[model samples]
Target chain A: MAVLTFLLRFLPFLLFGRKERPSPVLDSLNKLLPSAIIAVLVVYCLKDMNFRRIDNFVPELIAVAVVALLHLWRRNNLISIGGGAVVYMLLVQLVF
Target chain B: MKAELRYAVRQTLPVMIGYLFFGTAFGLMLQNIGYNFLWAMLASLVIYAGSMQFVLVSLLAGAFNLPAVILMTLTINSRHFFYGLPFLKKFREMGKAYLYMVFSLTDETYALLCSVWIPDHLDGKKVRFFIALFNHLYWITGSTLGALGGALLNIDLKGIEFTMTALFIVIFIEQWISATKITRVPAVVGLLCGLVLRLILGPDRFILPALIVTVTILLVLRPSLDRRSGEKEEEGSSVPSKR
Candidate 1:
């Protein structure tokens, strides 16, 4: 597992690091992929939920909405994440 | 060096909080599954990838299947392959620290390195190295403490895993707020690809396909994206071109 994980992380550096200039496609990816990948990751994190069930979905939806709104309002990472997680915990523990 | 470390600490404060909570949860989970602190430390030391480590606890608990383990590791961590792209040149410039940077580039660490700013007076390489190192240290400490304290500590953390989700959401919003017209295209592409593929393939099988489709779409759209970015640069917009 360790070897494979290292190899995956190392592959791009090994392929591109030594090049004087990488292909323009890669350069474009460097710009484009981060935002895209981050978006994918947000979905990935939520992927396993059984959204058909209200108990499973509502708290997550509300918490995620809280995170988005808090982040937009404050633009503070910690506040948004911490606030959302707290809301999630409370919803699961108390309300939902 | 001291100033760089200080800046790295401040910059990584959010990650520090998140990792400690998240890592401790992982450690507790592993301990519940009968792994000791040594195992937790070792996993955090080598495997280092956050979500995959959680997946590993299940893999270890179940019947040991090498093929399953290998496949899971590759699939879960495959997103890492793209992470090195932006840092390839900058990390190579860091000499001996390059490998460490690559090894420690977990999702949060990579996001921090990409988004944070270093002071003009500070050595960007050293600051980046410290950021990577500090995040790694936080994970190790959190997991180790969790493993060691698992039996004694019995707080309800049922929904705390949402922290990871919340963190990613915050990052997505950050990127959205900062993204230019062309940059936003890939994000929408990724979200749509991920959503559509998740619907088609279900959750377990969507990530790799979403990534491939997103990349292909981006490539097909690259000429237009590149041209627009070039025009933006010519207009002297503050957005830094990736190259």
Candidate 2:
């Protein structure tokens, strides 16, 4: 799962990761391999997703949402995340 | 080399606290469910998802049939697709280690690696590899320990799964602090979708759908968001002036 995820996350940078002025080693790898791995990952993700009835897991969902809002307001700062985490921790433990 | 590894470990210390305890719980849960260290390690290393590991304990115990496992895997991991999309190139040339590196990529590690300072003086991929390696170790080690604890004691792990929520919050905080409007946009979408999805799809299926929705929204806005994130990354990664 993580491997597929790595490929999925990293591959699209193929088009966008390129810089007119490139970092040779990094640039070459970016051009060549990311795509192959991404293909494999896509298969993996699809395979797992193809079947099954999904359930609702609320606490984490809410946490993701709150964090997203906080990210917008605070710009991914750790302190702000701290606030977000504290809220999530409380909510998950207490509310839902 | 060891010193660099040490530094990496130190940097991940705060996260370690959460990983360690959560790992212990996960380990214990799986152990109680008839899994051992090998199983624990495989789950942590292969799946590499903290929440999934705990949920997997039940799944592995035959809690659900094949269909349930499939649905759960997809739903739990949907967000990862986009997370990896941006870093594909880096993982490609990572050589033999690339496979292992990819196997261990998690939301926390990805966020940390994405924002890491690309050292001007040395091998960037190697540096990134170490970062990935470092986080992986934390997880691998944490899982081994968790399984050990579960083996020793008997307790219902259903409630303990909440650790993942806390962990996500921590990761969310870490990203939120360093993120900008562009990065935050996906997160915001995750939030809104997560909320609505939770209500509609319920908690279990919310993440994947929310991820799809968020990614689509981000894709639509990519040009503008990329322009913004690119600017921020420039400002964020540039060297500070030496006094």
Model 1 in CAPRI terms: which quality?
A: medium
Model 2's lDDT to the true fold? 0.56
lDDT measured at residue B49 in model 1 versus the true structure, 0 to 100: 87
Q: Which stretches of candidate 2 lie over 4 Å from their true place?
A: A1-96, B118-123, B150-187, B223-243
Under CAPRI classification, how is model 2 graded? incorrect
lDDT of 2 by residue, B57-121 (tens): 77778756877766666666656655555465566677697666656667666555654555455
Writing each residue's lDDT as its tens digit, candidate 1 over B198-225 gives 8899988798899889989988998998
Going through the candidates in order, their DockQ values are: 0.79, 0.13
Best by TM-score: 1
Regions of model 1 farther than 4 Å from truth: B232-243
Every candidate's fraction of true contacts kept comes to 0.85, 0.16
What is model 2's C-alpha RMSD?
A: 9.0
Candidate 1 residues A1-96, lDDT tens each? Answer: 998999999998888877798887888788888888888888888897777788888999999999999999998888888899999999999887
Error of 1 at A75 (Å): 1.7
Looking at model 2 chain B, report the run of 10 residues with the lowest lDDT sum: B156-165
